[model samples]
Target: MSLRTLAVVGTGLIGTSVALAARRQGVTVYLSDRDESAARTAEDLGAGRAAPPPEPVDLAVVAVPPSLVAPVLAESQARRLALSYTDVASVKSRTEREILATAPDPTRYVGSHPMAGREWSGPRAARAELFRERTWVLTPTRLTSKRAFDRTLDLIALCGAVPRVMGARAHDEAVALTSHAPHLVASLMAARLRDGSAEAAHLAGQGLRDVTRIARGDSRLWSDILESNAAAVAEILTRLQEDLTGVLAALHDLASPGPAVPGGTGPGGGGVVPVPGRHALVDLLDRGIAGVGGLDGAGGGRRGAPGRPEAPAFPVAGGR
Candidate 1:
């Protein structure tokens, strides 16, 4: 069914943002959360009424914890609370399987993820603009109804998010590499600073912030994310480790300039080449720039989506 009355199933940041966005679109929104207080708080923020769906709803958004989304969807479907169900859970494959095992008909069930969020947890940190212009993915199976899928896409557009179409396998694989692996890296790096001296932490600057911004996310929630996507995460991590080993070996060779070929040695053996002096270093830098340019085709502008047309850019001189 098309979206008219929407029931938001958890009043945390994502749910609250959804309510705010949906209301702005002139749709009726009903907010709910197991912690009824959170639902009330979201209502106070003008998200919606702190009540569950009474009559049938056009859309049900399960924005609860990753692990709880399946059970919630199953129950909602059983009780016929909504004509179509979707979730904002980060991981999808596991969630899809659980929903199938627990509730047979996912013809109306769709999986979704908005590639945007803050480290802060509840409604207080919610931003109506959080998902704006950000990529939002929907992993609809063959069983998913076209109406439900299209309405979900409409909801994504309503929230000012960019819509991406992907199957469950592709979606999981892509995020596992881009999102999940980076999070694990952030947490591992942040853990090193947990017990550092106050002086050391104060010495920390934007570089550390850039690296660990995501580490401050809810630990329990991330634990669920990592656990659910363990297989894909492990595969990505293995490739990362191999790259790290190669870099470390290169560093060792640099430190001890022996009879070694000098660049780096390996199977294909791009080999330990020569240590270039100043001019050579500059030449290598240019080569590196070219390499990166090749990876990023055309404008080399990564600030926008790949293959998407960007508005004309006006040149600005440095602060003169």
Candidate 2:
């Protein structure tokens, strides 16, 4: 079914962006948030009205953080807020499990996570085009009704996102590797600068900035995300730790004295010798290059399905 009305339950970046995108598609959107000011701000940005719908909306988009998804969904369901419900939470498995266990009518719900965001968050950072050409994952279990799933698909199309369906556990594992673990790694790398000397800080380059850019994400929100998907994230981090250990050992060997060579720092001997750890270091560097290159080789830039004609706009619905 075409989505005519949407009730966005959180007025943060994703929620506001969903509302803005839907509003652009002639879908009536109602915005709400625990933070009243945020809802008002989203309304000010022309996203939607900062008021509850007089009746149930076609769907309620729960745009809260991962940890809050289940409780917020439960409360929304209790209020009979919408005909169908979906969440934009980063983690899916835990939330889906909770909904199945707790929601009044889990059949009307489908779990979703949009693989889109800005480094800066909140309603002000939201844009209607934030999700354009991005992959939006839908994790519909056996309980999800066809109508609910179709409504969510309509929502995704309205937002110009390409939809891929995956099981909840698979979605969580994918994001743990792609999103959650990377955020933690970035933040950890950025934290190293906290104790650096002024000269060290001044010598910083764009590579460091690029590597640590996601470190600027909201700490509380990230912590919640990490906690919700702890198992999957921990698995990734464990592998990462093993990789780091190898890199660290290689670095230590490289720093240690090798055989003396004419131009080398080793003790003066006429003969040259192989540099310690050079092979390992070169191998690691090559692998890093290949890993990055493989992404492009695999058509990483492709988002949604190319050449899919835009669906006709939703029928304009009257505002309440």
Candidate 3:
């Protein structure tokens, strides 16, 4: 069935964007947020009306942070805000577990995470097109009703997002590797620039900018996300730490030369300093290239304007 009425439980970027996209699809949207000003901002921007739905809507998208998803969903369900419910929190496992324990009707709920966002947050940064061609993950449990799951797919369709279903734990682990850990790595690299010398800052180029771009995300929100997915993120970071240690050892070996290449090019062409662990450095670079190349067409799907629904290419089923 097509989604007709919708309630957005938060007016942040993801929530506002969902409201805007739904509105574009002719779905009535009611927007609400803890920050009244933010909800009004979304209303002023034509995302939706700034109020709770007078009666139950077709679907309610709970777009709160990871820690707040469970409580928000429970509260919304208590009010009977929508016939079905889904969330846009980045981490899914924790939220899913809590929802199962707290929600009045866990069968009416499906845990979801839209793989689309911007560094800038809130309604001001929201765009109707933010989810175009993006993957929206649905982590439905065995208890999830088919109606609830289908409404979420309708919501994703209305927002022009492709739906990919996975288990709650799998979704959390995947995002930890692809999104959460990468954001932390970027922030770590970006932080180094804070204490960098003026000369070093001046020499910074696109490579540094690209690596640090996501570091501009709201820290409070990111802290909540990282805390929710701590175990998965930690697992990835631990592997990264091991790699960093290996690289550091190789760098030290290269710096402490064991041999010298007799050449004619230093001052007036002297002997060249030998790089002892050049092979390790080259191997790392090659692996980096391969890893990046693997991303090309990793999630293939067709792009369309926001609100233009597309039929999913495959049958939708949640992972174990």
Q: Specify the poorest-scoring 10-residue window by lDDT in model 2.
A: 311-320
TM-score of each: 0.79, 0.88, 0.89
Ranking by TM-score: 3, 2, 1
Instruction: For residues 217-253, write the lDDT of model 3, one tens digit per residue.
Output: 9999999999999999999999889888888989998
TM-score of 2: 0.88
* Per-residue lDDT of 247 in model 3: 89
Off by over 4 Å in 3: 257-259, 262-275, 300-320
Candidates 1 and 3 compared: the better one by TM-score is 3
Flag regions of model 2 displaced more than 4 Å.
262-273, 297-320
* Selected candidate, larger TM-score, 2 vs 3: 3
What tens digits encode model 1's per-residue C-alpha lDDT throughout 124-165?
Answer: 888877788877889987688987788788789889888787
Q: Model 2: clashing residue pairs?
A: none
lDDT of every model, 2 decimals: 0.80, 0.87, 0.88
Better of 2 and 3 by lDDT: 3
Q: Report how far residue 268 has shifted in candidate 2, in Å.
A: 23
